[model samples]
Target chain A: MTERVYAGRPRPGNNFELYSWFFMRISGLLLILLVIGHMVIMHIINNVDVIDYDFVAARWASIGWRAYDWLLLFLALLHGANGVRVVIDDYVRRKGWKVFTVAVLYTFTFILLILGSLVIITFEPIGMGS
Target chain B: MYRGGEGQLSFILHRITGVGILVFLFGHVADTFLVGFGPDLYNHAMAIYRLPVIRVLEVLLAAAVLYHALNGLRIIIIDFWPAASRYQRAMFYAVGVVFLALFIPAAITMIRPLFH
Candidate 1:
């Protein structure tokens, strides 16, 4: 068995690690529902070939679909980013490399989140018809 | 470093699934962005995803997500509810049961389209 390692000195109040750990669980549970629903709808029930511009546009035309997808995007990204951070903390022993890797991860995650949010939130299905 | 213990196995699988989902996110975002280009482009991209290889990959992805989500709940209970920590092994088994219960049906749904 891989022995659990506690790497850093314990921090004081407003425990970020505790919050993040909790967030992972909450977001993960939500994601299972959202992502699985999405996969079922897109790949199983509807089929990917049927999910064209109009299909997407029609789906997004409803606020419900937009909200569902937005929530899915937000939770999945945050959960995945935090999970990767924990993985980095666990394996990357060197301080400098750890910082560098984490920095890159944060930057990449931030950009993706921003771009994804923009696409989902600002989507205009009517524009696609033109 | 993993010795094939139940705990270690779950731990490793969680990381693998986490990474797998992240990778899929990249492609998903890119594909979704194709909507901005027009229906033809978006439909074309969606069409490519219908290929046999991608369908097979979807089954594996479903399994990974199921295990990760179920085991993740177990980890949460262990962390927050002190008493649950004592029965961690049992919880792990429970996670497996729930995972299979969900995943088997989902896998069937995902693969059934391929044969039709």
Candidate 2:
């Protein structure tokens, strides 16, 4: 008789990895919608040619668009960061190199997340009319 | 090199596209953040995006995003429904069909401006 391996549900003990795995799928489902919509509006419908400072200013002038962008920024950064972290864990074997790369990854992800959020939150519609 | 089947191919493509998009995202956020520097600097950066080469790259990026998104859905299905693995090969083809369907039109739209 062939042996049956225990490849069913994840066993208890590591809640963090379990949550991270769940986050990837959930965030991914949302991203397919969020990012595809973003592309259609920014790249297809509008095209880069039409997008300029004034265009952005006008868009951000509305709180709705700001909120939409802020959500996208937040989710995409976390999703991408976690995805890369998984990749690093899989391939980078050497202890020192792995630690260094992961450190850099976290550092950049943190900076970009903060920087993007600040831009969205603190944007002023300068010369865009109140 | 395991040299497996469709599953292997999908897994490899997922990694490649995910990394590519992440790298692009960092640059994109930095560029968009330039808006705070005022219009002159922002528009100057926007001009680079308008260049023909970057436009072509933009289409490639769209393809990457599309593939990653579709394949991601496939992964989810297989994860939630173990029965789905039996048909994963067919679903992989389905992902391809949907990718082409959506990507071709979007690619055309993005590239159309280059001729103008």
Candidate 3:
């Protein structure tokens, strides 16, 4: 027998909740590092004039930057989407609405993430095919 | 409708900021494409960004990017890592500490050069 002191029903497992909470802080710290690295290389290195289409082409030519950007894009979307999911749970009282909205949100988030990653990793910066 | 102390406020603010960043991202891409228009047009457009007002705006933009990105990381920490949830409040303050430590110095160094 368990003493029920709380008003609302308790969340089952709370696995998602636990992970979501941890993700925000960790990702935020990492974003600071990522953004600083990006800005230093892109902006402060040789001034903005050096960055042309050729510069972009040369940079993305490397797998290192591709992965860096991939990490950034996915982390950003997931972080933002999880925040949105929490908002839906907090405000949308109807159970059906909550499920529907979260599903749509996640779908969009993942689709964008996948598409962006593909473009970053496989992009041929010049007009011609590689 | 959100009350103080509720995590909901943070979520709402974050969504707004995220949307803002998305818009900013699109505008940035479009501006990059504008560079392809022509050298003269690109130079003129780039020149507009060098004005005093634009410089001020850039500073604000930098702060916005930093704040959103940093606070966002905080939200993630609280969401996924239950083991650290106990220290959420302390962790939030730690973010502020980190922000100030970097921001203050960066601002001073950035401005001093402009003045001298």
lDDT tens digits, residues A65-117, model 3?
A: 87987787766676667766776787889999999988987877766666666
Q: Score the docking of each candidate (DockQ).
A: 0.41, 0.52, 0.20
Candidate 1 lDDT over residue span A58-105, tens digit each: 898899988998898889888888988988998999999999999988
Give me the runs in candidate 3 sitting further than 4 Å from their true place: A1-13, A43-50, A92-104, A127-130, B1-19, B22-58, B69-101, B104-116
Candidate 1 vs candidate 3, lDDT winner: 1
Where in model 2 is the C-alpha error above 4 Å?
Answer: A1-13, B1-3
Q: Which candidate is the best by TM-score?
A: 2
Q: Quick one: ranking by DockQ, best first?
A: 2, 1, 3
- The candidate 3 chain A region of ten consecutive residues with least summed lDDT is A3-12
Error of 2 at B22 (Å): 0.4
Q: Rank the candidates by lDDT, best first.
A: 2, 1, 3
TM-scores of the candidates in the order shown:
0.85, 0.93, 0.57
Which ranges in model 1 have alpha carbons more than 4 Å from their true place?
A1-14, A126-130, B1-4
lDDT of 3 by residue, B51-111 (tens): 6666555555556666676666665555455555556556656766877876665555444
TM-score of 3: 0.57
Where does candidate 2 clash, by residue pair?
none
Give a tens-digit lDDT track for model 2, residues B1-116: 21378767888898999999999999999999999988889999999998899999999999999999999998888778767766778888999999999998888888888887
